[model samples]
Target: MTINVIGIGLDGVVGLNESVRQIVERATVLVGSDRHLRYFPNHSAEIIVLEDILETIVEIRQHLDTPNSCIVVLTSGDPLFFGLGRLLVTHFPPEKLRFYPHLSSVQLAFSRLKIPWQDAKIISVHGRSMDELIQALQQGVEKIAVLTDHTHTPKAIASLLLALDLPIDYHFWVCENIGSEDERVQQWSIDEAKQEIFAPLNVVVLLRQSRIATNQSLDLANLPWLGIPDSYFCTYDDRPGLMTKREIRVLILAELGLQPGQIIWDIGAGSGSVSVEIARLFSDSTVYAIEKTAAGTSLIEENCRRFQTNNVVSIHGNAPDILHHLRPPHRIFIGGSSGKLRNILGVCGMRMLPGGIIVLAFTSLENLHTALSWVEERKKSDRSWNYRLLQVQLSRSIPIANLTRFTPLNPVNIMIISR
Candidate 1:
């Protein structure tokens, strides 16, 4: 028995090559959606409409059990790219299945727009939450290609983006019925897209507009590992050094062990220095900068705009209270907890995913003791809990008259707790 998984685009049978076409023509059992099966009305194969995915796999196996059975499964776009090919492969042996991939709708969408997609972030909202789309937008991706479904339509996505008040300016392109005769590619602003209806079969492309000049340079490409300097952030005039110093920020990020696509929470994100840096360092991750103070929240917004760090979402509310609404975090940085360090730690511990990390930066001995006590309490409950403490003292060279002087920064106590 030989199972051939063929990928078909909107062009349908006309897009198949001779080799793939022969495979489909010779198939004794053809598996595909009603729409795809209609493309081969003259074929002699027994057409099986895909309804229940697991049931379909069972049917495929039943055909394969017979001698000299030739089965062909038709899927949309590249079979392995968010397509049914991956699922079929898992069910059948590698030697029994052969794959013939067609260009994905995402590829077609980008081709229609005449834009390079190498750097674009590709996401699918089909049978998934709209949160993926929001996360991509928040990441400050220059270009994004989204696959839409019946529920997560272009209009629904547009409405969400508009409601979120996305910090970056983006031009939305809706590519409908790609490769078909009635194919349409329309570019609109977010406001325009929200009011318009698009075909069920469509792809949405988001292209971020160029940034305007500001006091802080938005050119993040050439920055070093430590990220943007503290001077770049918009701190309160009265509290100049309120933001995390560059050295401490670097160490905290290292200890947090950030990975792409992870969700991070920066509680007490003052000036959003840590949040902005995390966003920049991990472009695929989403950062929530939670601040209670009005001044801190405003500074965070200002710094995010200045750095063009759209991925860092600034939440203006007290911790633990607002933490419940956010998704479980992979990494959390507690930079300021007011006097509620224990409560914040408790909420984060409950909400963090297994193996998630929490790093707390404290300037006062009292907060450090509170965090240490919390860690001790957690260890008693869960012996698998591990923690470490590091004291970082940084000094920078400053030119005084004709001589350079070293200015020592305040020592920061960092407590890392991992589950």
Candidate 2:
């Protein structure tokens, strides 16, 4: 018998599909993280907390090749998002893996908050950084939901937002143990949220549209990243520039349709090109940048300072991991995800507000195909998701036979999503 990987959303067993629930209940050998296993501690199935997933995978594989072993791997939220189902599929064929997914924890958070989440930006900042999150806010995304780990507490998130000078009057909802009997939900001001104790396993919902009447450079909905050029500040390289293209960026911004002071995430910020422009466009908004590269993080700070925008905050870390720990956003974008597309979208789908918007930029067609496949799957369980294709061609005046021609560069794909 092969291993059966199960995805446990916020509701734990209560929200699981019948087949998935049956799989967990009937499993003779259950393996999960301590927290996940504890959710079903009373189950008669034998359980083991998997601390080292690599080691656990190896052991599970050995048993999978055996005759009578019933192995089940449990995960928090969507296993495909930051969960283990995908990992198992990598080592084995599709036929060898069975995935049972539940409504993600972020979904439960939204339900508890009673906010329509169709258009929210959802991200998991568990072990990743907040650079991207900051950038998104600067661009004016309105509603955001964050899947948090232990370190990315609401207080830590609040401190970061304060440092960035985001509007202090926005609403903050910290939901603990969503879908569980002891579930607790608290709403507070940015300052007030800093004093509370939030559960390690929790979710954050941020509402960026409080006063609704602040005037800014760009419409909160049309906030653009990388709108301002990289040459506006220092950079690690001197070629094309350490930033997303302005023309395409403008379209992405147009797609976002953000509001003033909305929460946003710019994951994998290379040079704060997106973050700075977002801050500049929405002076009242707070933008978070998640950059793992040292030069990139430094560049974000440098650019923000050079542009005199105080709404940008750069975090030095990776995504999904770092993303899980930060506050959620009304708009979420993956500027640089290091090829972790499945995990990225899973987190986004799980954490995005029901009515939130998500934008994914792809420079190549192959990746665009892959992203489409992933997004298509998300549309199945999730609500209505709309996709748009923007093929941009820009030209600069050059001495081409005494004439400047607008040579079409490779087409870039910008996928705008609405939940």
Candidate 3:
């Protein structure tokens, strides 16, 4: 009833220690992939190919019931690191299992490149979505090590990075067949990487290039933070102060109840002030800034770079027209909706997660009434939403002729709807 889950390096059986080698030799039942089992062709143990994980678990359970039986499950790299060891431990009793881990492929790859990996972000794309990889890149990490599979190869990763239009420069290192005689490590630029194919088993490492200092260094310390001065943002020359005011933006952010890993949408994101702040507040979250005007979209991009908010993605298109293409959001902020306020609200209400929050900032009574009517209509059918309205009127102090005078700013109506 005893089981030993051992990790094997890419070098195969030769990489095992004496104790692990003896355990494998004396095992009554062996479980692993076909490639792993081929390493012990002359062994007399009962070999089970791990084609279906569920079926293999059932088989292992049956074998454990037999008296005086020893089971050894072999996996690549560190068994507990995105490997079968953790899964087996979850299904089986912990006291009955023992784990012997080897250097992980991530470690071997980093070692081959002579790079310190303690600070590097490690991710695995084997039989998983590439979204996590994209998110990591957007976070502006200095270095990353990605474990890739056949479908999510190094070349595909390179193409995805290029498509995102990432501002930071990166050098891609493709490490293939690690720890074996046929091992290969090659460095490539983003352009050169997309043109070549790599072995199915490989690790893709992205190292950000260091930036050179210039006159622009003075602005680095003045990066905007929460409730940043409105003057910091670039607005249309003719339509200055068009963006959300600092005071109201702080309130809207508080109402949205931002959380880590949540997806947020900023419709009609003028200059993307709100979206950039949200990305900064929730560094792990994804923020999509949907703006229609060409100038507005350009401003958002410029602001994102200026603020070093790489997590914010600016979509240059009208909302409700392009909302269908984006992932469902946990929080949505509507700054300007043209006349489609009702339609945009409906789409957001439908796509937002249950218990999600939606906040709208309207300067016109017509838009405010439109939102109120939509909420009232939805309330009749579904009572799950809670609504609150706040009107903000403020004045700023300006010094004139050695005397301070108060200048009143435009009033805004904020409508918050939460499910």
Candidate 4:
């Protein structure tokens, strides 16, 4: 006996092609939700309402024992596209099941809007957590199609988007009753979506307005005095979390002991997070953010503009080689040394202004030892040179079901060297 999973749309029975319609007509048994079952009320098949899925599966097993039973399980949209087909495959053998997929709501949604969906990120919050949707938003994906449920409605998603205070903005589109007679596709502002009511069957689409953050709308006065949130700055597309996190940035900023009119060099600046923060704090200070990758340099410049930190000069070149062209620094931050920690340290140590402080952040023990060795070798030549180490470990709270749990960040060992 084979379980034929036929994909239906909001348009119901009339939407099925002749070939698929014949399969449904010859079925000896039928299983589906109340909505899906309503499409074929006059059918003579033995009906099973999918209220308790485990119980329904047991009934299906019993029906399978019959020698010549044809079981048809109805589902909405493409059965394999975040639908019931996955569950059926896990419980039954591949040979015992066949799938006839209709157009998915996401596909219908994009079609209604006349938007190409090949690159769109599809997320389903229907009877599931919104963790994936939240992560997609954080990443600032170009396009997204979200299948929502009663709890995670369009309005709720809009509210969550506004609350995130993201660097980028999205054009919110709600497609309701897609592929049905009463289908409605409308674009709404993030604020307007919060006050409106949408149909029960709806898909939320988010299209990023721009690739870069909207810096003109940024209210710098409202920003924190120190350690700006990581979300405010636009890092690399591939390496979003590569920049110095806020927790560690705070410690690095404190160790720098920043003062006005000081020259600061941020070596291996991933996205200029440290440079921008220092520039914002002390406008008189000049921050030279040296990054090797062109993409990294572009991101550093973009972040500088986003935060309106004009004092930050983004330099696209490797450190030590690039350090010689710049003015001697009163403070140095080594966020990344690019496997040349010794050379960077030698240049920084020799060129630094008297009483200048250098803070290096390391996640690897090997790099930490390299810096320690470099400092020890330098201490013999200069008695005033000395270093201190601080190991930082931090964790942030995250929701786990009804309770909260702590998720630890990467451990960092900070080496502070001063004369």
Root-mean-square deviation per candidate: 18.4, 22.0, 18.6, 3.2
Error of 2 at 75 (Å): 1.7
Give TM per candidate: 0.55, 0.49, 0.54, 0.86
- On a 0 to 100 scale, what is the lDDT of residue 80 in model 2? 79
Q: List the residue pairs that clash in candidate 3.
A: none
Higher-scoring candidate on lDDT, 3 or 4: 4
lDDT of 1 by residue, 1-419 (tens): 78899999888889999988989988999999998998998889888899999999999888988877789999998999999988987898899888899999999999999999998899988887665666565455678899888877887777666544433456889999998989999998777887898888999998876421234355566766465555456665534546777778889999999999999999999878899888877878999999999988988888778777779889999988999999999999999888999999999999999999999998899999998898889899789889999988886653322234454678999999998
- Residue 308, model 3: lDDT of 79
Candidate 3 has its poorest 10 consecutive residues by lDDT at 209-218
Better of 1 and 4 by TM-score: 4
Q: Which model, 1 or 3, shows the larger TM-score?
A: 1
Judge candidate 3 at residue 108 and give its lDDT: 91
Worst window of 10 by summed lDDT in candidate 1: 398-407
Residue-level lDDT tens digits of model 2 in 218-336: 23344334455322344443222345766667777788887897878888878776777677778887788999888788777866666667888789997778878777788877777
* Candidate 1 colliding pairs: 138-311
TM-score of 4: 0.86
